[model samples]
Target: MTAHFVDLLDDLRRRSLRMAQLVEEVVREACEAVFQADVEKAKRVVQRDNDVDAEEVEVESEVIRLLALYQPVGSDLRLLCTVLKVNNDLERIADCAVNVAERARHVDARTLAGPYEDLRQMGPIVVHMLHNAVKAYGSQVVDDAQRVLLEEDAVDALYGQIIRRLVAEASASPAKIAAFLDVLSVAKNLERIADHATNIAEDVVFVCTGEIVRHRMH
Candidate 1:
């Protein structure tokens, strides 16, 4: 790759990192909206989804353009590919935040105090996972990416616990089924966010080591 192409690639990587930061904020706001019952914060999260969607398209376009024009190989090609994949994952994470925010609009925090405590714990863990994933992507460090992978299991376990608790609670109080479903929606979205974060981390590992560590256990 030429010097000019290398500079452009660096710019694209920085742009993608900025988008990651924005998505992280959206997730944090969505969590606060739900846990604190802040309707305005939920609305802000929903509104920011539009911005994330537009940025996703722009980032993908730039990646394709770079590939066609520069025909980058080796690490340059891997970096472009990683940026494209991470861009898509970040957009999806934003959408998951919107889903959580939408559920926050209806879910009662008071009602979530008992059986939904697991979800409350899951939110911060998911956010932390995403933060580490973005950091790994920025630094292109295998260790940071591996750390994000380690946290995914904890989020999954908490999600499973929430599901079991909701099932039992719903069985006992059929009338509160709607609230239970709302709580479940939030948990599901949080779990999906964690999955997307893991995907980003996996891409980072691939970029750093040229090794595909996606589908194997751990």
Candidate 2:
């Protein structure tokens, strides 16, 4: 690759990382909105989704442009591919945050105390997962990515617990089904965010080790 191309690639990677940081903040705000019942925080998260969406497109375009113009091979190609995949995942993560914030706008956090507590626990785990995933991406470290993978099962388990509790609670209090569904929505989005974080980690592993570990059990 030419020096100019390499410089462009580095710039694109840095841009993607900035986007990742922005998405992380959005997730944190969304979590605060839901757990603390902060409507203004939720609104901020929603507004920031627009920026994430636009950056996703720009990153994707630059990735494609580099591939077409430079025809990068080996690690360069892998890095480009990983950037594209991570870009998509980051955008989806922002969308998931928006979903959580939207649910927060309706539900009363105090009323969701018992059953929704699992979601509270799940939020930090998901955020930590994404943080590790983004760190792995930036550092291109297999170990950091592996750590993110390890956290996925915990998030999944908590999500399942929340689902079961919501089901039981809904059956007992049918009139409060709307609130239960709101909690379910938040849980589902958080679970999806965890899944995206896992995808990012898998991409990091692939980029570093050239291992296709996607479908294989870690």
Q: Candidate 1: what lDDT?
A: 0.92
Model 2: residues with Cα > 4 Å off, grouped in runs: none
| Top lDDT hit | 1
Which residue pairs collide, candidate 2? none
Candidate 1 vs. true structure, TM-score: 0.98
Candidate 2 lDDT at 32 equals 89
lDDT of 2 by residue, 1-218 (tens): 48998899899999999999999999989998988899998999999999999999999999999999999999899999999999999999999999999887798988667647778899999998999988988899999999999999999899989989888988999999898889889999999999999999999999998898998787
Candidate 2, position 162, lDDT: 91
The alpha-carbon lDDT assigned to residue 122 of candidate 2 equals: 92
lDDT tens digits, residue span 1-218, model 1: 48899899989999999999999999999999999899999999999999999999999999999999999989998999999999989999999999999887798889767657788899999999999999998899899999999999999999999899888978999998899889989999999999999999999998988999989898
